[model samples]
Structures are given as C-alpha cells and as structure tokens.
Target: MRIKVSLYARRGEVLDYNHCYELAREIRRAIKTVDPEILSDEASRLYTFSRIMVKNRSFELCRDGMKLLTSQLYFFFSSLSKNICDSLIDGFVELRRLNAGGISFEVSKIEVIKESKITGNEKLVTLSPINFRDRSCEDADFEEKFTEKLTKELIRRYTIIYGSNFDGDVRFKVLKCKSVAIRVGGKKYRAHLMVFNAHGSKKLIEIGYKSGFGTMTDCGFGMVKKAKRI
Candidate 1:
C-alpha cells in the first residue's frame, strides 16, 4: 500500500536541503504513538517494512539559506495492515505540526493509493536514488557490490515479512549512476541516483518497492517506484 501526504507551510519558510531524515522521524513518531509495539526492540531488529519519498518539493535561494515550498510526501508499505494504516493516518492528522530540518509545516491532506491507482510491475523495476554506502567505492566495483548488497537485503526483508527465505537468481547491471552527496540527520554521505536492470521474482521486486532498495531506507534514503523503462 502507498500513502501520500500533502504538507503546507507559511510563506518564507526556510528548510534545509536534507530534511528527509527528520520527516521520516516525525512519521515514525506518529506511528509509534499510535502503537508502540510497532517500534519495539524486536521489531527494530527486523527488516524495515516501509519506505518514504518526497515529491513536488521546491526550494528558493536566499541570502540566509534555501527556503522550501510545500509539497507531498509518499509512504509505501509492504503489508496491508489496517491497524498500521489507520494509526498512521489518525496520528498524523491529530498531530499536525511537523518539523523537517528544523522547518515547521502543517499536514494539510492525507490520501491512500487504492489498488486501482497502485501501478507497478514487480519483475522489471527502476529504483530512484539509493544510498548504499556512506563513502564512494571504486567505480568498477560499485555495481557488483550494489547488486550483492541489495540482494542480501531483499532476502532478509523477505524472510522477516513472509517467513521464508528467498533463494532465487538475483542479478542486476547498473544502467547509470550519478554521484551525489546526501545529508541526513546532520551528517553527509556520498550516494547515487542509479538506474539498474534487475532480474528477480515478483515478491523480491515488490519488497524493493515497498521497503526500499539499499541502506538507510528508514531514513528515507532508498525509496523506489516502478519505472516503465530506464
């Protein structure tokens, strides 16, 4: 399931560039408040079953800093749990104040992506930027390492969610990767916006879609959506 949230801020609100981490924390807080069990130590050890993405964000340059315009936030879940979904929606709506990178905003709208609207084919997928490591690796070795790491992560998350290990042929080749720097929780990390060709089961692909592809997904790092073509 996918959930989209609309946020609005007053004019002249300054927001830092790397605010996804903070935004993710707020979302988690809302989920935890509604049901603390979701964040228990045991659960923490398990694979993250959700992913977050920011959309329609706009920033303005100012002498002081960059100012941000209101935008939409997306959340993807692996399971269709009513309790989890309801808690997220209710908690977020009740707690209207949200702060991202120290900038405050109001939650204006919350909408669920129904089955009809959820479009994606799991077999062939395209991931947005996936922050796999904190520092850069050899350009030649990056693709191999990325594919291995992602395959392992998918297996882990698949076991946690489905109660079985996936033993399928997982293969990928990097179509393109653009080097970039990402700041989250006041720390900077080297990352990439990579397009890859993945050959895997539908379940594994779905896991990547819902739970994110690489590391730091919970901090909003590796969220992915279906791409018709790379």
Candidate 2:
C-alpha cells in the first residue's frame, strides 16, 4: 500500500501548510485506520506554496496506485474512492494543523498502470436464440420478438462475464467505465455498455463480460480481441 501525496495550498491566503514529512505522517495514520493490512510504500506529501510542483507528482501517484486504492476501497470492498480518501486525509491533517476545519485535495492525477491482457484468448463467440418466440413489450416498450433463447443466452453470457470478473474480484477497488466505441458489421454501436468500456480498459473486464446487463440491441456476432498482457 504505497501512496505518494503532494498538495499545494496558500499560506496565509488560504494556505495553512505544515512540514512535508509531518503531513505524510498524518496520512499514514489515517490510512492505518482505513486498512491496517495495507503494505504501504511511502508517506503523506504536503507540498506548500513553495512546492506547488508536487501537484503533478500527486497526479502520477493517483494513476500508479489507482488499482490498489480502488481495489481496497471502492467497488470491491466498498471502502471509499481515491478522491474521498484523499479528502478525508486532507481534512484530518488540516484540522490538526490549524486546530481548525476544512481542507481538500482539489485535484489529483494518476500516471501509468499495470494489468494482464491475454491476446490469444480474445476470440469472437456467437450466441443466438435457440427457440424463436414472439417479442413482447413491458407496456412502456414496443414489442417485437426474435428469440427468447438468444436473450437468455446473452444474459447468461453477461452473468458469466460480469458475475465472474467484476462483482467477485477481491483485488479490484474501483470499476468505472467511461466511454466505448464499438462496431458490429462495420457499423458504429453506441450504448451504455460501450460507454462504460470506453472509460476504463481491462480493469472493468478482466476475465468477464463487458456489460452485465444483457443488451437487447446487442445483435450480430463480433470478434473479441484483447491486447497482449503486460
């Protein structure tokens, strides 16, 4: 559990800064409460007005440690998001410094990430409705049926993918899908699932389906290609 934090705050203007190592110590203490089992690498970083450059460094840390931070805090363990944790640490440290209240990590950036990508395993698989049935609507929806079996199969595949890789991952902390650009049969495919996939890469779909929600419009067979594992 290694996190390197750097902050830029005004001194008398709006800045109540403290020693760099001391700030790191406060962060270390706060993290211990968050997770005692953390294998922390470094300490808190309070970069005062003279050291505003630390912001860039903090951003890089956000990226490097994002995976671990998210896995331990957010989606997997339901602990907290990086922003939230940073905010908490900031507040805790600030309050102690001024014996006052209110402080924040205005912004942070994460640089570089590590993950496993299996290119050979990326293959196109087709699923279809085994049984044809009349499509029905849910009152608000227009009805047109193709194959219920196909829907079930898609759902099953979705469950297999999402249920397996997503909800069950103990090492994952955060799972945010930003945007996705997909095409089926040389046509652009726009949907929520695609959007999510666009946000984060392999993190959202390690060994599972991209979208847990079986999309009704997710038609046609397509190839599943993956990047080489790093």
Best by TM-score: 1
Clash list (residue pairs), candidate 1: none
* Model 1, C-alpha of 52: deviation from truth (Å): 9.1
Best by lDDT: 1
lDDT against the true structure, per candidate, is: 0.61, 0.26
lDDT per residue as tens, model 2, 1-230: 11223333332222122222232344445445545545232112111111122322322233212111110110000011343344445544543331101233322322212222422123221111111123222222211122223334443443543454323211111112222233333444332211111112233333222222223212311112222333
Per-residue lDDT tens digits for candidate 1, residues 50-137, read 2233455455666544665435444443333455666778888889767875567778788887532232233333233577773354
Candidate 1's C-alpha runs over 4 A off are: 41-58, 61-66, 69-82, 115-128, 134-138
Q: What TM-score do all the candidates reach, one by one?
A: 0.78, 0.18
TM-score of 1: 0.78
